[model samples]
Target: MEELKEELLSTDGKLDFAIGFKGTVAIGFQSPQSGYNLKVIRNTPTEQYKWGVFEGVPSVLEKYGRVHVINRTGSMLDNIIFYRVKLERAWFTNALLQELLNDASECVTLQGESLFFRHLIVQSKLIPLPVYLENSSQAESEAAIINLGHCIKNNMAANIFNKDLDARNYGVGVFGGVYLFDYDALEQFTEVKIRTNQNQFEGEEDIPEWFFEDGVIFLPEEIESGLRIPNRSLRQLFREVHGDLLQVDYYERIQDELGVGKVPSARVYPERYQIN
Candidate 1:
């Protein structure tokens, strides 16, 4: 940690980094002596300690085969954590660093000799799911969509709800592995309410009951449309293969299992690998 801190402080204006959404900055570097490539992301700190983002839920993230947070340590009340992420695959974030730098004059001004980050998360680079789908072959895109479902289901099995379901919140690895990288909106499934709008509204004046409900309320049916995947066939493929994800019963069933102390295991591998 000390070595990394010293190196980061010394680089200052020489460091290459990109500004991302929700006040994140992605920085990549390689060790000259060890020849190891490393990447880190600086996140906006929250008022309270986050179990999943901090020391509390590494086990859960690992169990679900999510990004492995190598190390997290930092000062500054605003930037509380600095993470060292594993560099196992290619990375493509929300926006290209160059484009963000071009538009962000303020960030450009800040990237001088004294640039410092108070919080950081180190992880492999990932192609934002949307970007991957837009550029890849239809077959690969199909696989990625399926993997996205796995990522969602895996997190749900662990009782974690990624409050944001947009495809942009997810990333695709070069090998077709899809993972959720954003943790800002994470919440416990038990704390979230599952609702439906199948026959609730009659007209524009008919405000749904969930409209008045407090806390996180999720309408399962919206999962498909909420993703906003552009490909019509790919979207249909997702619905056909993982259609259960759009049902209130599916989420309710998982919640029921949790309520009965029957938490599901984090199955990270393909079923074909399972030994009978």
Candidate 2:
């Protein structure tokens, strides 16, 4: 851990760019000895709840295309925690990365004031999903969207739910993999209530039912819209490829399977690789 701290303090650790609401997420030097770059996330002392939630994530999530966490360390004196993740050298740089980083950095205080915090958590990095979508070919975009569905299903099968299904929270990797990168809004799948607005309205009811739900309620039909895909055709393609995800019955079935201790097999490999 100290070695990581020292390495981060060196000249090589200066961030390429930093962004995030819960923390400062930046592309930074991987290691003094390594040639490629990595990602570094630093959170303030007050956000320990966020860290606790993230730390509890099962290691099994890696198979679902969650970021590969490398290390986690913190500093009581400096009032910050650090997370590091490995990243491949970017295939291409997109302005969106900088734009989002700039937006997220608006409220940043830790690095702006320059009281360096030595603690961190590390993991592997992938190209931000929106960036990849904006830049990749049509075929690549379709493949990524499919991977996104598989990623979500894999997590759901493991009884996890990403409360924020935004495209910004996902990324694409060198292997054309789509992965969930953010965890601040993660929740237990079984703990959430899946409902549809159709149940609450007969013809034209004014009051929305979600206003009355106790906690973590989700409208399955809203899942695709929640993703906020930028392209219309791709969004329609998402519906075509994974429309089952947008059904209450589908989620209920998954819950039932879990209740029976019959977790569905995760599709960890490419679709072509069948085990039969």
Per-model CA lDDT versus the true structure: 0.56, 0.56
| Cα distance off (Å), candidate 2, residue 197 | 0.6
Compute the lDDT of residue 15 as modeled in candidate 1.
Answer: 28
| Tens-digit lDDT track of model 1 for 1-276 | 455445444543222332223323233433332212233332323343233343323332332233232211110001123432221112223343443334332222223323222223444456677878778887788888887887788777777777768887677655666777665456777889999888765665777888898888999999988788878998899899889999999999988987888866454543233478
Question: Any residue pairs clashing in model 1, and if so which?
Answer: 81-120, 82-120, 83-120, 83-122, 84-122, 85-122, 85-123, 91-125, 91-126, 92-126
How many residue-pair clashes does candidate 1 contain?
10
Deviation of model 2 at 14, angstroms: 3.4
Which residue ranges in model 1 land beyond 4 Å of their true spot? 1-80, 83-112, 201-204, 265-267, 270-276
For model 2, the superposed segments whose C-alpha errors exceed 4 Å read: 1-13, 18-118, 200-203, 208-210, 270-276
**Cand. 1 TM to true fold:** 0.64
